[model samples]
Every structure is written in structure tokens, then in C-alpha cells.
Target: MSFLIKNKLGLARTGIIKTAHGNVETPNFAFVATHGFIKSLKEEDYFSLAPELTISNTFHLFVTGKHKEIKKAGGLHKMFPLKNPIMTDSGGFQVFSLGWGKKHNIGKVDKTAKNPACVQPVDKSTRPPARDVSKTTCVAGGVRACLPTGRLEKDRNPVKILSDRVIFTYDGKKFELTPRKSIKIQEDLGADIIFAFDECTSPLHDYEYNKKSLKKTHSWAKECLKAKKKNGQMLYGIVQGGIFENLRKESSSFIGALPFDGFGIGGSFGEKQMEEVIGWALSGLPENKPRHLLGIGAIKDIFIGVGKGIDTFDCVIPTREARHGAVYSMEGRLDIKRGVFEKDKKALDKGCGCFVCSSGIKRKDLRILFKENIPEAQRLATIHNIHFYKKLFGKIREAIDSGKRSNLKKLEKHYKF
Candidate 1:
């Protein structure tokens, strides 16, 4: 795998990531294909959209035992019949999503009205016997402090975190995933690019919690590198530091120094601190390698990430929102299901060339389809939304290639960012 930089404008640049499958343009958006396919869309629908890249979830495939079938079919590309490059993230984000994320009810960004404590203690009944539990101190909110022996005590949280692995109870079945296991699963999936297994911290975590988590993340990165045996797959290390600048820089420096093909900025951030957090995360990475901003794809955040030097990104916003009847446009997102659009005859997006828009689907028509629970509503919306982001990134690459800040400024104004 190789990355060739073709143009640069400040931190933002246009480049190509060469892979066994194909070359993916830098400053691009990788749509989420968690189950080896984009949700609510058929093969023909995706072929029409023809996304540059798609990212699958290692955790989901592994936990659901789908990796076996994927391997049997000669990997994701053969199974999905895709010609574009693919990326598979180490099941690391599940460390947060199934752990603190579920416990605190928060996502990558903390937008809750009330902030929870960084460390909430688990219920006493869930702890081990007094003799065994005495060795470790319980932090507030049920989080157990690492014992002097370097072992972690299980908490009441649905997901259990240990020094060597994570335990998840999904669909009433227990699944254990270690760094080595994560790497093995990615190899079975045979993605062109795979990520090192690192714990994704929550925005609610404090300095001490993140500090300890970083130690585990850094250690796991090394283990992942040692476990990878595939010759063609590119491995990217992940940087995790919650929302702290110092820790973000520390993690970036540690993970960046490793010999991974590229780097991914992971972990959580405050709603308004994404730009600052991204800057800190990229501070110590090698300038020549590609940088991916994990799990972020909002229109405004995409510009922020590109301006701060992120090369690629993956998120479910476009497809997930589309499935709910939200349509993407330069003007803004439109709720096509709303009654206000009952008589509207406007195109999904004026002058857009997406399959749905080019076919001349009217707002009222889409509204009627959605209101009647027709499946085509989601299919059309997903295609339109995916195309919208693909076009946006293409224009961003053009703006960067032109070496004119005014071009990018026009994009922000045009996109209402």
C-alpha cells in the first residue's frame, strides 16, 4: 500500500491511497458498510452510487460469526462483489460503545444536558468476594482501579474490560476479543486496510481514566503489529485520548512512532472541541502517511477534519439519517416525511445528478412513499445521501488541488457550514 500526495493547500491535501483492491482518493468519506453492505440498499443501488470506499466493523462480523462465511467466500470483496478499496476497524470502538457508552448513554460526542461523573462505581453486589475485591480500589461510578498486580476487576457494566481482552455479552452470548483475536478477524475479512486494536475512551472519562486507558491502548497497538501476518493488508495504529489535549498528543506521539502504514484518530470529544482535539491528535503523526478521522461524518465536522489534515473518514450519518427519511442537500437536511412536503414538487436537491434527483423524483412523491411505509423511500434516500457526500468530497479535492483558499471558503458557504 502507498499514499501519493498530488496537491496541498495548508493542512488540507489531495492524494491517493493505493491498495490491492484499488486506489482511494484522500480527503474522502468512507461510508459505513458494517455488515459487508450498506443498509437498505441493494447491489444495483450501490453500484449506481459507486462509493470510493466503505468500512466494515470487525466486532460486528466477529461477534455474529459472519467472519467464517466471509473467509469461506474468499473475503469481503468476493462476498460483496465490490471493486473499491475496503477498510475494517479493529473491534476497539465496541470497548466504548458497549461499555461506558451504554452505561452513560452517550455517543462519540457528549451532548447530554447533564454531564455524568467520570468514574461511576458499580453496584457492590456485582463485585467479587471481599477477600478478592480488597486488592483493588473501586473508583466512583463502579470503575475499578487497576490492581498493583496489573489485573482489572470486572464491573457491572455490560462490557467487561481486562488487560488482555474485552468481554461482551451480545444477544445473551458472551464473546471475548483480544488484540490478537481482533487482528486475526481482520485478516479473515481480508480488507485492504485494517486498524490496530485500541480501546476507544468516552468523552465522560477524566484525565486519570484516560491516562490509564492510553497505557492499554499503546500496549495493544504493539500486540496488534506483532500479530499481523498478512502481507498485503495495511495496518493503521489508532490514537485514543478522550478529550484531553495533553493525552491526545501523548497517544499520537506513542502510536505515531510505530511502523504502521497509516494512523487513525479515535476516542471521544466534546461537542465543540472536535477541531482542537483533531489538531492535537495529528500533532505527532508522520506527515507523509494518511490520517483517518474515525466515526465522524457531519458536514461541518468533515470540513473541520480536512482543514486539520485528516485524509479519510467513516460514519453512518448519511445512510442512517437517510433510512429515517432525511434527505441531504447543500441547502440543509430535509425531512421528506413531513406533511409540509405533501404538495412540494421540488427535486430532492436542485440540479443534483444523483440517481434519485436525475430521475426527477419530486418531494411530495417521496413524502407519499415514506408515509405509506414503502421500502423504496429508504433506498432512494440512501442513494441520494451517499451521492451527496461523494460529490462534496470531490469538490473538496478540487478546491485543495487548486491551491486557493477562496475555493474552500466557497464550499463552506455553499454547504452552509
Candidate 2:
């Protein structure tokens, strides 16, 4: 459990994270395999793509009853046939999302966009204002009236937040997930890396409520650390404070002072607050340990994060975007389903050196393959996007090592993100 930096330029560095399965290169991108596998791609597909690491969701695996089977089969890499390392989330995000966010018509991580279908009448006869909406935004009070229709939908079973545990009701049954339970589950379905159970608060939560929740999350962080087993799995303590600067600093100080192997920056926030919030949290953390920025995978965000000292990131964006006919290239995002690409004979990306482009596969052929709705198109598109991300990290690392970090700034303007 050692994170040794090999090179550094400003806060960004190229490092090696020592893990049980293997070493993960720093400033790396982890492919999202939420349900034990990336969508539209099988275990065999990963062998060729060979991501240095993959992130799985604990909530999905536990609810689907796959955790027991995976534990019995040994570990994620062995059970899933992946040669690289694996990291499992504490499922805290789902708890907030399925319960609070759903009830209030808010998204877990997204805040910029609005959903039109989520509009519903505000129920004034329900809960009191103290427990309902706030002055600026409706969190609990007037939630139905204040929010846009596209962001929230009415749901019956959302999670209930208690001081010690989160109650999730699904399919007519209730499941109580405590801090200790989350750690035990992660240990059961062993992965090279695991996260401490903490409350991932929504941005809609006001400062007073976020402050109270921060105290609860801090309590859970200690409980998780105390309950965690030293079975060679690296445990990462998560920092949560919504978007308040003072709370962010406090949460960072509390979580960073702990003896966990690593640290993860968690909680909901808008795009404008990302860099400033991250800077606040990172300022409190020790420079020696690895720091993972949770649930961020956009290219522009990557540049911002790496420059500010984040070591790793995980998101479902690339693969999910690929399934929706979007792929990343050096030029920018390419939509294979576009009518223009139906006859375009050029490669998916002229500057891309991935197998799909390097093998001379034209955009028209790829478009037709994808239009046929075959699995190969999705897989190929996913692979190309992944390769682009991997290469991006590689270039970032190289720029840092060679003392030419300005190249990263240039990429920001070139990509226009």
C-alpha cells in the first residue's frame, strides 16, 4: 500500500500506486464496469482494450446478489477474467440518488441540464416546510414547485436518512445499509481498492443541512475505518461537504487525517465549483498518498483535475456515450450515427492511433456497423474512446515528466471543452 511519485510538475505527477492485484499507473483513467462488466462488451473484450483498472458498483452487485457469488469465486479480477486491478464504490451515491434526489427531482451528479418530464405539481399537503423546501431552492419544501420538470420525477420509494444508517426501500422490501455493512460488503466481494462508507450529499442541500450531514458522514468515516479489514485491499476515505468552502475544508481535514491508504473526493457540485472545491480538499490532504476524484470523466475536467493533483478518476461517460453513438477523437467527439458519416470514407479519427482507426476502418463502415445495432460497433467505439482517454493521460504524464506542462493548457483551448 505505497503511492510513490516518480515525477512532479506543480501539483500534477506521474506515480505508481501499489495494489494487491497489481500496480496502477498514476493520472490514469478507470473504465466503468458498474455491473461487473462494461456494457456491450464482455470479459474477453477487456483483454484487448486492457484498461489499467476498472471500477465496479457495490450497490448494483449487492442488490443483484452477485457479491456472494463473487466472494465465493475469489475476487473480481479472478471471477471476471480481468488481468488488471479493480475498485468498488461504497454504494453511497446510490443511497442519496435513489432516495433524496429522486424524491426532490434532482440529479445525483448532473446540475447543468434540466429534464422536462420531471415536472409535477407541488404537494403542499404533504410534509411541513421545515422538512421540505428551502428559500433558494426546494430541497424538501416546495420541491415540486421550484424545480424544473426534467430534473425530478415522483417516486414512491426513496432512501431515508438516519443518523447511523440509510434505509433503501426497493421492490416492496427495505434494506438498511450502515457504515459497517458497506465495508463488510466491499470486503466480501474483494477488489484491489474499496471506499469508506460516507454520505454523498446533494448540492441542493442547504448549508445547515449539509453541515449536519457532514457530521454524520464524519462519524461514518470513522466507523468504516474501524470496521475495515486489512486483507490487502486499499481503503479510500471519502470527503463530503456539498459545495461550502468551510465544510469542504473541515471534511477534508477530518478524512485526510485518518490512516486510510488513499482518499476520494465525493459529493455533488456544479461545474463552476469543481476546481475551487477540489483545491480546497486537496490542500488538506497529504501529498504522499493517492487521491481519486470520484465520478468525473470528461476530458476538460480531466485536465483541470490532473493539474490540481488528482491521481485517478472513474466515470461511465466514455462507454455510455459510445453506446449512444458518440465517440471521442483527437479532433473532438464524433457521432457515428450522423448522416454525414454515412458516406464519409475517412477513419473515425485521423489522428487516433487506436485499432479501429489504425486498422483502416472508415467512418462510413463504422456507421453502418453501428446502425445495424451489432455489438461489434459498440465495442469498437468503446475501445476507441478508451484508447483516446488512455492516450490523453499518457500525454499528460509525459508533459509533466518533460517539464513542458504548458501543453496541457494548450489542449484545453484546442478541445474547446
Candidate 3:
């Protein structure tokens, strides 16, 4: 429950989160450990990649029956042997994206595209259908390799949302994920930071639907706070209003007035509306408390969120994108699998100081790694990309500390959201 801010440059501030496991530096990235572990990397590898915090999915863990195992192992830090702080998402985004998105064949977050074809599948691959080898992935270097998706399969147990609870159907059995239940599960799993259970509506949801959903979110936020036990774990109340400004202000004000430790900016918005809603929410939130913008990790998005006073962020983009050969460069993303890189001798980013780039691995060699389907290739790319994000955020903090906001502005040309 101890969060201290040591410095502020405009809206951006440097801070630390004092948790039972360890302290996490602010203006930091929280990498995704979707099902209680980072994909394609071992627990020890997390120590080397060095994000101050990691986030796990509450819904995924619950569905996969890992929640009980996680608890039995004495919470996430002890189970994973991570010395850093841990955060558990409320499972709202996955409910909206995987369950809700699949039900309607709508896009996960983008609101502009009405056609289902315009929506990109959550998986980026165009390869032919493969077997469902997801559960039988090989363990290498003491880490379980992540399984790639096979044929697009409809979610057998789509999440049915209601005002008080969400019904999840998995394995032919129905499970209810209520606000109170979510809190208890997270408590048992015991992350340093956990979010209140709230409904995360798709960007495709209309204003009327969003308004109705926000009311439920507010009620749940209160319930989550009431259900929280005094265990020194930080509970962040989620703000949900979709893309509407008025609703955003109302939702923010209600959640911000509560004595919760921090705030999580939830729900989805059109790309053009993202900044406005984020600004509105931050305007109403308590400045002394930290704010986490959920499920956004693009470099431009990070810059925008940081500028808007968001203290922390968690996204699957760095590692997920790297697994697909989309890598971050100061110049923007470099798709290593592309033919252009097949014979290119230059490093992924000559200016980068990451292990891969520092080792002088050329673009052609990187392309070969993915082309030949080398397993370590994904891990190396993930490490380098994560390292790149670390460096990027470091630069962001430095720019803010030195009042070089213009440098951040210039970066807009390279990293467009």
C-alpha cells in the first residue's frame, strides 16, 4: 500500500510501488503473463528482461484451473520466484475481446471498422490450420513454450454479461465470475496489485449500452472495495465509460472518490477518441494515486498515456508482436519475416543496445530464425523487443525529467498509434 512519488515533470512523475514482494519503479511497463506465466520465456528469464512488474490474467487462470494451483504454490511471487511486483487484471478485457468479440465477430477494441473482415483476428498468422497442440507444448530451458493458434475456433464458452455477474461457459460447465468472486480468487492468488472486477465493453458498444454498463461497473467497484481484506495488497478501481466524455467523467468521478489505492482506465475507444477519454479520466482521478491504463502497449500509446499522467501500463504487444516477427525500432516496427530483411545485413536496429543487436545479429539472420522456425528465435526477439521497450520508457522518463517534451512530440512521426 506504499506508493511514493519522488519527482514530477509536468504530468509525468517518477515513483515507486512498495509491495510485499518488492518495489517497482514507476513510469514502467508491466509485461503480460496471461496465464500466470510469460509465454515462451522461463520465470528466470523475467529477471533478465527486467520489467519492474508483470500482469497475469484472472479469467484465463480461472478457466484453465490454474488459480487453485497458483494459490497452493503460495501466491504468484513465490510460485514464479519473481522478485518484482505482480498485478492481476480484473479479467474484463478478455471477457470483452475473446468472449464478446468472438460472439459477435466484432473487432476487439477498434470501433471504426464495422465490417468483420476489417477486424484483424486476434491471432496474426495466415498459415494453414494446424493441430490443437496448444496444451502439449514442449518445455525448454525450464520454460513451457507458448503454443500457436491452429484453425480459428469459436469460443465454446462465450461470456454472458449481466449487471451483477458474468457467466462463463467452459468445458461444458458454467462458472460465474462475479465481482465478489473475482476479488476472492485474486486474494487467494495474492498479487501485489489487483483490479476490481468490472465489465469492459467493446468499442463497438453504443453509447446507451455503455451508459448502462458503466453503472454496473461503479456498483462492482464499490463491492470490490468492500470485499477487499486488509492484506496490504493494492486494489485498483476500474473506470469504465467506453468512448463517451460525459460518461467518462461520471465514471471517473465515482471511482476516484472512493478510497481505493489507485485507478485502472478500462473499456475501449476508437483510435481518435482514445486520447480524449484518457485525458478526461485522468482529469477526474486523484493525482496522488497511481493510474494504470489497461491493455495498451504500443510505443505511441505509452507516450500518450504517460503524458496524460498514467503511472503504469501492461500490454501483450512487446512479446506477442516479437513472436510474430514484428519488432520495435526507434524508427518504428521492423517485420523481420519480410523478404526485404532476408538479405539485409544490418542489425534490427543499429542504435539499439539490446543483447541481439549488441551481438551484431543481422536482419538476414533474424529472418532466418523465424523462416526456419527456430524456437529460440522467438525468445531472443522477445527479449530484445522487451529490452527496447525498457530503453524507450527510460528515454521517456528522462525527457520528462529534463523538460524535453518536444523530443516526445517528434517521436510521433515514427510511432503512430
Candidate 4:
């Protein structure tokens, strides 16, 4: 695998990632195809959208025992109709997702909002006995009493984090995933690009926690490299450091020095700190190899990432939001389920070339379909949003290739960013 830079505008550039399956353009978006396919879309629908790249979840396939069938069928391409470049993430994010994310009810981006799942710490005198605690709700003088803060501590997390591996408890069963096992699974699944297994820390984790996690992540990266036996797949090491600038730069320098084909900037941070965090993460990375921003795909964030020299991104925002009746357009997102659109006759987006728009599926029509609980509602919305992102990235590449900053500025205005 090779990354060829065709054009450069500041840190942003237009490039081609040469993969075994095909070439993927730089500053592009990889639509999430979790569970082997994009949810609610059929083969025909996927073919119609014709995404340039798509990513699948390694943990989901491993847990569901689908990797065996895919390996038997000669990889994801043979098992599915998708022929474009595919990327499979290591199950690292599950460390945060299944553990702290579930326990704290938080997401990758910390909004600085208080966790609703958390309660005030209880006074020792007001606390109920250990045996009665299970039978009665935390109450004091007819008011809801605070609970013990220790209940939400690290040990209470459903997923156990270890130095070399992680143990996930799901659906009443425990599954262990090690660095070597993660790489083996990705190799068996046969993707053009695979990620090194690293512990993705949360934005809410304090400095001391992230520092310890970073050491484990760095060790896993080396183990993943040693575990790779396939010469065809390109492995990208991940940089993890939570939200600390020093840790981000340290991880970046360490992972950047590795022999991996490319690099992925993983872990979570506050929304406001994205640009700063990305700068710290990319400071020590080499200029030649491709850099991917994992799990980030907001329109403004894509522009920010590309400007920071990120080559690719993968996120569930487009398809996931589409399934919930949100439609992406030049004007902004539209909620098709809203009553305001019930009598509107405009297309999903004016002058859009997507199948749904070209077919004259008016907002009112989609609104009625969603109201009627028809399955096509989600499919139509998904197709449109996917095309919107495809077109957005195309325009971005064009703007970069043209060597014109004005073109990029025009896109920001056009997208209402």
C-alpha cells in the first residue's frame, strides 16, 4: 500500500490511498457499514449510493461469530457486494464504549454537561444498610437521597481493561480480546486497511488515568504489529491520550515512529478542544503517511480535520442520523418527521443529484412515508445523506487540488458551516 500526494494546500492535501481493492481519495469520508452492511439499506441501495469507502466494526463481527462465515466466503467483498476499499477498526473503542460510556452514559465528545446517571454522594449517617440498599431506593426524609460515588468507580465498569487485552461482558457472557486476536480477526475478515488495537480513553477520564492508559496503548501497538502475518493489508497504529496535550503529543511521537503504514488519531476530547487536540496529535506525525481521524464526521469538524492534515474519517453521524429522519442538505439538516414538512413540496435538497432528490421525492412525500412507518423512509434519507457527504468530500478535494483557499471558503458558506 502507498499514499501518493497529488496536491497540497497548507497542511491539507489531495492524495490517493492505493489499496488492494482500489484507490480512496484523501480528505474523504468512510461511511459506517457496521454489522457487515449499512443498516436498513439493501445491496441495491448500497450500490446505488456507491460510496467510495466504508468501515465495519471488528468487535461486532467477532462477537456475533460472523467473521468465520466471512473468512470462509473469501472476505467481506465476496460475502457482500461492496467492492470499494474497506477499513475495520480494532475493538479498542469498545473498551470505552462498553465500559465507561455505558456506566457514565457519556459519549466521545464531552459537552461538559453533568451526567444524569450520577447522584450526589450520600452522607454516611443517611445511608441505608448494605442489605436494605437493594430493597429500598435511596431516600431520606421523603426526598431522594444521594448514593455512594464508589458505585460508579472503575471496577464497576462492565468491561475489564488489562495491559495486554480487554474482557467484555455482554449479553451474560464474557469475551476476551487481545492485541494479537484483534489483528488476526481483521486479517481473517480481509480489509484493505486495519487498525492497531489501542485503548481508547474517554474525555471525562482525568490526567492520571489517561497517562496509565497511554502506556498500555503504546504496548498494544507493538504487539499488533508483531501479530500481523498478511502482507496485503495496511496496518495503522493508533494514537491515544484522552484530552491532554502533553499525552497526545507523546503518543503521536511514539506511534509516528512505528513502522505502520499509516496512523489513526483515536480517543475522545471535548468538542471545543477538537482543533487543539488534533494539532497536538499531529505535531510529531510524519508528513508522508496518511492520517485518519477516527469517529469524527461532522461537517465543520471534517473541514477542521482536513485543514489539520487528516486524510480520512469514519463516523455513524450520516447514516445514523438519516435513519432517524434527518436529511442533510446545503441549507442544513432537515427533520422529515416534523409536521412543518407535511405540506412542503420541495425536494430533500434543491439541485441535489441524489436518486431521492432526482426522483422528485418531495419533503411532504417523505414526511407521509415516515408517518406511515414505511421502510423506504429510512433508505431514502440515508441515500441522500450519503450522497451529500460524497459530494462534500469531492468538492473538498477539488478545492484543495485547485490550490485556492477561496474555493474552500465558499464550501464552508455553502454548507452553512
The 10-residue segment with the lowest total lDDT in model 4 = 116-125
Question: Clashing residue pairs, candidate 1?
Answer: 119-140, 120-140, 120-141, 120-142, 121-140, 121-141, 121-142, 122-142
Lowest-lDDT window of 10 residues in candidate 2?
Answer: 116-125
Q: Model 1 over residues 58-123: C-alpha lDDT tens digits?
A: 999998899999999999999995668999999999988887666545689765312234223322
Q: What lDDT does the true structure give each of the candidates?
A: 0.85, 0.79, 0.77, 0.85
> Model 3, range 5-88, lDDT digits (tens) per residue?
867766778787788877877788998888777777766677667677889888888988889998898888777755678899
Residues 351-384 of candidate 4 have per-residue lDDT tens digits of 9899999999999999998899999899899999
Per-residue lDDT of candidate 2, residues 39-75 (tens digit): 8776666777788988999988887789889888876
TM-scores for all predictions: 0.90, 0.89, 0.86, 0.91
Highest-lDDT candidate: 1
Candidate that beats the other on lDDT, 3 or 4, i.e. the better one: 4
Q: Cα deviation in Å at residue 75, candidate 2?
A: 1.5
User: By lDDT, highest first, what's the ranking?
Assistant: 1, 4, 2, 3
